[model samples]
Target: MDIRIGMLGFGFMGKTHAYAVENLKYFYKNLPFTARITALCTAHKDTSCAACAEYGFDRACGSEDEIISDPDIDAVDVCTPNIFHYETVKKILRAKKHVMCEKPLAVTYEEAAELARLADEAGVTTQIVFNNRYMAPVLRAKQLIDSGRLGDIIGFRSAYLHNSCMDPNKPAGWKQTGEYGGGVLRDLGSHAIDLVYYLCGDFERVSGKSLIYYRERAGMDGAVWKTTADEAFYITAQLKSGAIGTIEANKLTVGVNDDLSIFVHGTRGSLRFSLMDPNFLEFYDGSLPGGDYGGDRGVTRIECVNRYPEPGGVFPGVKAPVGWLRGHVGNMYNFCSAVYEGRQAAPSFFDGARISAVIDAAERSDRADGAFVAVAQP
Candidate 1:
């Protein structure tokens, strides 16, 4: 099978997705289908054409409509901004094409729920880009939890932090504006939320607080502008299983670069993972007997670097230190494999909608002065 993709937007994420598609063969051995970006579209025709020429796409589309209407394109990859997701993904579903979308599904829960409904009705393979879930350590974490290694998750604390918002002189892009559905909650919080949901379970209630440290910042054109988005967000949530946890997503932290970390404590054992230390997953098994000198009782570092199951871990060797890009590659590969096998992808639109619901509840809680709000089910 040959899966020709029509990719929307040519920004940083666009380039990342393209790299994932182009490098799939090298990372995964014996792929059942070949996939490539056949058509590219962006906000500007010139930029699209230039990207096509430079990246070897077959054609440059004047608009997303051209990509959606094309007959040869089997799937549409939505790498556009958060504000564009609802409309663009709706059209892709209407066209009966498979879709791979970036995080946070949409700006609002209503839109995300509708998208989830449409995706289910369309009966086409769809995937949300929760790339962190594809990391070997994350995958291992899921396995251990599923195997009851961590019995009855009691609590968890997760954080995704960055230093981009620390400087007041920095220009405010779409990410700092409310017009584009940009905020720390939607940008970094979505990943943190999804990981907890994936590992722990469904959320029951949440209390949230949003902070905007820099009310004003330089605009894209170097003009003074008021920041309309939250620079940091904090959430205290309770899962349906009675497990409670705290999630913190912020861009204002000092001396941090993609410092996403999570600690889950359960009755039997606990799990810890950090993006900065991506090569290993720390696991503490309480079931082990403890004696003097801490006999076989402590955190065990499981080397997960590039140690993917069969078909993967073929290229770059299994011992190679896994980087951030590897997660994207694995995510892309999973989506392609699902499409090739005529199966629903993991982290589907429903999962995205669920996460959207959690974010919606968090935002509501924030508006109510950090009052607890129930997470609505889609």
Candidate 2:
């Protein structure tokens, strides 16, 4: 089967998705379906045309409507801004086409939930871009946790930090403003929250605090502008299993580049993973014997570099170091395979909605001055 895709937006993530789709054949052997971006759509026709010519897309479209209405497009890949996701996804779902959406499904939980509903009604394969979940080490962590190696998750700490917001002189993009539904929590926190939720469990309640250290920054146009989004967000959440954890998402931290780390502790064992050090997962087997010299009780670093199962790990030889882009490739492969196999994707629209619920609860807690807010069940 050829899964012809109509892609919306051509920004960083859009290019990333294109790379993943174009490279899937090299990463996964014997892929059941071939997928490609058949059409490209952007806010401007000229930009879209240029991207199509440069990136080998079949055609360029001026608006999303053309892509959504095209019968030849079997799937729609949405890499647009946070603000446009809700409406664009709604149309694609209505068209009964498969969808692959980026993180924080929508600006609000209500919108995310609505998209989830439409996705279900459409009966089309859907996936949310929680790319971190597809990493080799992260996947290994999930396996251990599911096998009860982590026992009952007692606590966890996850954080995604960047240095983008540290300099006040830097020009603010759409991500630093509420007008485009951009906030550190929604941008980075969603990934952190999803990681914990994916490894640990569903959140029961949460308390959150937001910080905007630099209230003013230069806008994209070089004019002085007041920031309306949180530069940093902190959340204390309890899972339904009674495990409590803290999640931090900030862009103001200095000297960090795409640093996302997570530690989960349980009664039987513990797990640690850092995006900066993506090739290995640190695991402590509590069941191991402990001698006077600490014996085998110490943490063991499991090398998970490109160690994906059969069909995968074939091109890269499984020993090659895995990087951030590998996760995107894995995510795209999963979505395409699920669509081909007539199955639901793992991180489906429902997962996106659930994560949005957690974000919604955290935001409400922030508004209430860090009071505990119950996460709405999706």
Candidate 3:
């Protein structure tokens, strides 16, 4: 099977997904299907044409609609701005094609819910790019939780932080403006929220606070502009399973670089993960025997890096240190395989919509002065 993808947005994630599709064959030896980028579309025609020439895409489309409606394209990969996702995803699913969207599926819960409903009705293969979940450590974390190793999860904490917004002199990009659906909460919080939901369970209620430490900053044009988006957001949540946790997203951390970490504690054991140390999952087993000298009671660092099951971990040795981009490759490979095999991919748009619903509640809590807000069900 040949999976022809028409990708929108030639930004950071757009290029990443393109690389995944192009390199999947090398990472996973297969006798099943071939996935390739057949077309490219971006905000600017010149950029799209240039990308086509440079990246060897078959067609340089004028708009996303052209790519979505094209019969030759089997899948529509959405890597556009958050504001554009709802409409573009609807168009893709309505065209009876597969869709692979980046996180925070849409700017609002209502829009994401509608998209999820339409995707279900269309019965098309869909995936949301929560690439962090594809990390070997995260996968192992999920396995341990599911197998009752982290028995009866009681509480958890997660954070995703960056220092990109720490410098007041730095110019504001689309991510620093509210009109573009830009904020650390929506950008980083979405991933953090999904991590808790994925590991623990559905959120029952939440209280949130948003902060803009730097009220004004340099604009994209090098002029001073008011900051309209949150530099940090703090949320405290309760899960349906009676677990409570804190989730935080911050862009004003002075010396952080993509710092995402999570800790989960349970009655039986605990698990910890940090993107800084992406190759290992530190697990604590309370069931283990403990003595005065702390015999076999300390945290066990599980070497999970690059140890993917069959079809993966072949090109790169299993013990090799895996980085962030490897997760994107695995995510894309699974989505394409799902499309080809007529199966639903993990982290579907429904999962994305769930995070949107939680975000909606978080915003409500923030507006209501941190009053607990119930998460809307899908």
Q: Compared with the true structure, what per-residue lDDT tens digits does model 2 show for residues 84-188? A: 999999999989999999988999999999999999899999999999998999999999999999899999999999999998888888899889999999999
For model 1, how does the per-residue alpha-carbon lDDT over 1-378 read when each residue is reduced to its tens digit?
A: 999999999899999999999989988999999999999999999999999999999999998999999999999999999999999999999999999999889999999999999999999999999999988899999999999999999999999999999987878888888999999999999999999999999999999999999888887776888889999999999999999999999999998999998999999999999999999999999999999998889999999988898798787777578665668779999999999999999999999999999999999999999999999965
TM-score: the better of candidates 2 and 3: 2
Candidate 3 lDDT over residue span 1-378, tens digit each:
999999999999999999889989888877499999999999999999999999999989888999988999999999998989998998899899999999889999999999989999999999999999989899999999999998999999999999889888989988888888899999999999999999998999999999999888898888989998999999999999999999999998888898999999999999999999988999999999998899879899999978888787786767567665668779999999999999999998999999999999999999999999999996
Look at candidate 3 and give me any clashing residue pairs: none
What's the TM-score of every candidate structure? Answer: 0.85, 0.85, 0.85
Model 2 residue 90 CA deviation in Å: 0.7
Report the error of model 1 at residue 87, Å.
Answer: 0.5
Which is superior by TM-score, 1 or 3? 1
Measured by TM-score, how close is model 3 to the native structure? Answer: 0.85
In model 2, the worst 10-residue window by lDDT is 317-326
Error of 3 at 118 (Å): 0.7
Superposed model 3: Cα runs more than 4 Å off: 323-378
